[model samples]
Target: MPRFMGFVRMEEGQGNPPQALFDAMDEYIGKEAAAGHFLDGGGLYGTEDAVNFVVKKGEVTRVDGPYAESKEVVGGWAIMQYDSLEEAIAGQQDFAELHRKYWPEVSMVATLRQIPDEPPTPAED
Candidate 1:
């Protein structure tokens, strides 16, 4: 089985989703989880709450919030098990439709990536 992560990204000033969107998302998550496709997922706070650290030449430097130059930040993520990348993409499309219904004013993009499988055991573990 292939595992995929749907990373939800939103613009810097998009703000938080409305209560209706939250309710809809909760219902959606339940349905997906019940179907056994969804493994784990959750929404995140605004990007202002995030921090960025850059280490160069053994020197660690940190910068405060508003990372990525305020272009876009991940607002949520979902881990799912699927058979193929096409299936993963379809699942994300469905989620986007739900978001469109609830948050018409806000724009978002969901990116999907496959999770690599762990290496096999040596001989006996």
Candidate 2:
């Protein structure tokens, strides 16, 4: 199975989706999980609340908000586990359709990748 990241973008000034919709999506996702299609997933707050960072000349610079962007910014995301890229894309397409109905301007960007087996450890012993 492969891992995928579903980055969700919301229009400016658009608040969070309705609880009922979310609950329905949760139930659907739960079914997928039972079928071994889900690994882990969650929502997130607006990008304005996110801390941005950059590196230059080996120095790190911290910004108060999300990094500057020309297009819609990522508002939230989910990590999905699927049998193949096609399956992951199909799932994302379903999510996008649902999102469009509830969040018309929202978009889902899907990135498929392999989940690493271990987290990176600190250098210090």
Candidate 3:
């Protein structure tokens, strides 16, 4: 089985999703967890309370969030395992559909990437 990370992105300050979306997600997550496909995942708080430690050269700069100009942000994430990339994509597609059915007015994007099982080869100069 291969594992993948799902980054759920949406606009900042978009507020909460509808109650129906949560109810639908509860059932969906329950099934996925029971099947052992869902490893772990959770929603993240808004950027207001976020702290960023950026490194440039040898110096580190601390930047506080609450970014007023950020139009999109990662609102949540999920770790899941599936037999193949297709299966993982289908699973995520189903999740996106839930939002469409419950909260069609809002837009969302879920970026998926596989967790590499091997170390990368060093590049030649």
Candidate 4:
């Protein structure tokens, strides 16, 4: 089955709707799991807590903030296992609708990719 990464973006300083969003996400995940489409999902903190890294001249520079300066930053994300890109997209659309209801400025960016047979190794490991 193919896997999808759904990135949920929201405006900075917008009140964190973690509880409400998580509630809706829980419901969605339950339904998807019942349908055998859900794999795993979770929310993330603000950009201040997220790390940013850039590779330049074979050297990596680490920054203590989000890499992007758009009004919206990645607020959270979900990974869904599905049979096809269409199915993954359908799920993204559904989540987008839910977000629209509670967060008008929220935007969802989704990418569907086949899960690798072997997981990528961490640099330190």
What TM-score goes with each of the models?
Answer: 0.83, 0.72, 0.92, 0.73
Given candidate 2, what's the lDDT at residue 110?
39
Q: Candidate 3, residues 9-66: lDDT per residue as tens digits? A: 9988778999999999999999999998899998999999889898999999998998
User: In candidate 1, what are the lDDT values of residues 1-125, reduced to their tens digit?
Assistant: 89998898888777778899889888988988897889999988876767778899999898888676677788889899887788888889989988899999987898888888986568976
- Local distance difference test, per candidate? 0.85, 0.69, 0.92, 0.72
Point out the worst 10-residue segment of candidate 4 by lDDT.
106-115
Order of all candidates by lDDT, from best down to worst? Answer: 3, 1, 4, 2
lDDT of 2 by residue, 1-125 (tens): 56777766654445667776687788878887898877677767666777767798999988775535625566666778887878888887887676667656544453445565577787996
Query: Considering TM-score, which of the candidate structures 3 and 4 is the better prediction for this target?
Result: 3
User: How many residue pairs clash in each candidate at the backbone level?
Assistant: 0, 0, 0, 0
- State the local distance difference test value for candidate 1: 0.85
Which model, 2 or 3, shows the larger lDDT? 3
Off by over 4 Å in 3: 121-125
TM-score for predicted model 1 compared with the true structure: 0.83
Candidate 4 lDDT over 61-85, as tens digits, reads 8988754565777667677788888
